[model samples]
Target: MAPVNEAARPALKAGTRDAHERRIDRAVALIERAIAQGEEPPELGRLAEAAAFSPFHFHRVYRAMTGETTGQTVARLRLLQGLRLLASERRSVTDAALAVGYQTPQAFTRALRQSLGTAPSELRAEPERLWREIDRLAQPPQPEQGEDAPPLRVEVVSIDPFQVVALRVEGGYEAKHAGYERLFGWAGAHGLLDRLQGLYGVAVDDRRDVAEPQCRFDCMLALGEGVDPTGLPGLRLTRLGGGRYARIRHVGAFDGLEAATDALLARWLPASGERLGDALLYHDYLDDPDQVPQALLRTDVYLPLQC
Candidate 1:
């Protein structure tokens, strides 16, 4: 066989990189979709098969590409989903525990505290503080800088009442795409796709305040006029009572939304003299993640304010 041409080596290497990234992305998406659909965590062999890698080498490959073991990924995803359920107040700790694949509530609590440094009860009571603590612990120490950061720009705007058909997802916010996939499928099947006026996320639990398992995010499709959700079996129809809101536009990855929200609730709200309203915080997804790059994704976070 002829030796590989030196000039073509970079192209070959780039092709290999692309193939590896595609495989990793496929594996990650499979894991996330299964979790979102409330399915048991896929076995390692199953994941390996899905990624078209040998079972023996898949674990190492996954870890090398993602910087975490497969078990670690499953555990993190499960724990985050469990926390979302817990925060929703709709499920008992025991229920949330089982729903997220824990054998019992005690086991879930132990893992929660060990991994997140907060108990389920503590998360319910002091969600914001505990969430902040988790975020702090997850990051490396930062250097103190002079106060020259740009101010968080917020606008007080009145929104009209609207209704949405939402699918409740009991997982970390990152798993929400699965819920959207289901919602879109349902709409497409019923020929209601054209009636989807906007895409919204109802944060049942403030992600910045709650543990991942205790957070509840609803993947919502804003309904156009005259659409009733009476026959939707698995979905909920929620009417958002339109009112004044403090809105902050977050630009960049979804991961940064938590910090933006913290800035809003901690700094902006107090300074703006706005009291929290009797409604949940929600998000308007301005750009579709599938179409936009992570750094360019836009989300408008809205905190309801009293009239």
Candidate 2:
């Protein structure tokens, strides 16, 4: 990846930057709670209060940070959850439509097709096939000598095959931790939490490649032999593709991701000869920054290589 020439971008003052981040985090929490409840969303004023910002500014900043209005964010979340239900429960298209608060089936299908790029029927069929494969691999013995580790570059290396009990997430990256929370909650409910030994935040879309902020990511719980991926509620088992990358590990909250990513693109990539690959530069969380000390976040980032 070549260094991104950001000579024209403005720099933020330190104090103002911190204040902005704190405000953004508060706003994100309010919206996430509303989605998890899955009922009538809170009023705009109430949400503004929760974020400690005036309603007018709240609406503007919330959209600025998350790339969608509060209302749009909640609506998209319901639709993603509805799609999951459709794939896993094999619910009638009509029922799935209504479950997500859609008034009519036609409306739901139309939106689903636009977002997913496939008809409901075709989408449903793919899950069925994935489920079957996951079920079949239900206790394969680990290779005695596991191989496939490649030179630690910032490039995507072909990863060895593995199964995961995953929850599909569709939204901007800013709201994704909520999806991870729900996924972890589901794992706990099913006694699968212990099985997430090698957790992965599987990003299907690279933000660097697309201008739109509306993209989906799959927050996957790495599965061992005991976890069955078949017929699980909104669960999926997938094989991740690998290639080249530019990797880094940053300590602290995901809030600094944009800055860290920018640094990698502007400072590091140019220093090295590697070019960003077609795949998104990947970030692997090695330690829970919340639990670990400030200096010990084992987050490894990978940027794809070109030459």
Clashes per model (N, Cα, C within 3 A): 11, 24
Worst 10 residues of 2 by lDDT: 1-10
TM-score of each: 0.51, 0.39
- Lowest lDDT block of 10, candidate 1: 1-10
What would the per-residue lDDT of candidate 2 be over residues 157-268, giving only the tens digit for each residue?
A: 4443355656776677545777777777777777877656665675554443334356667776665656766544677766432444445666666545544554454444
lDDT of 1 by residue, 141-201 (tens): 2212112546877777777778888888877855688889888888888889977788988
> What is candidate 2's local distance difference test score?
0.56
lDDT agreement with native, every candidate: 0.70, 0.56
Cand. 2 TM to true fold: 0.39
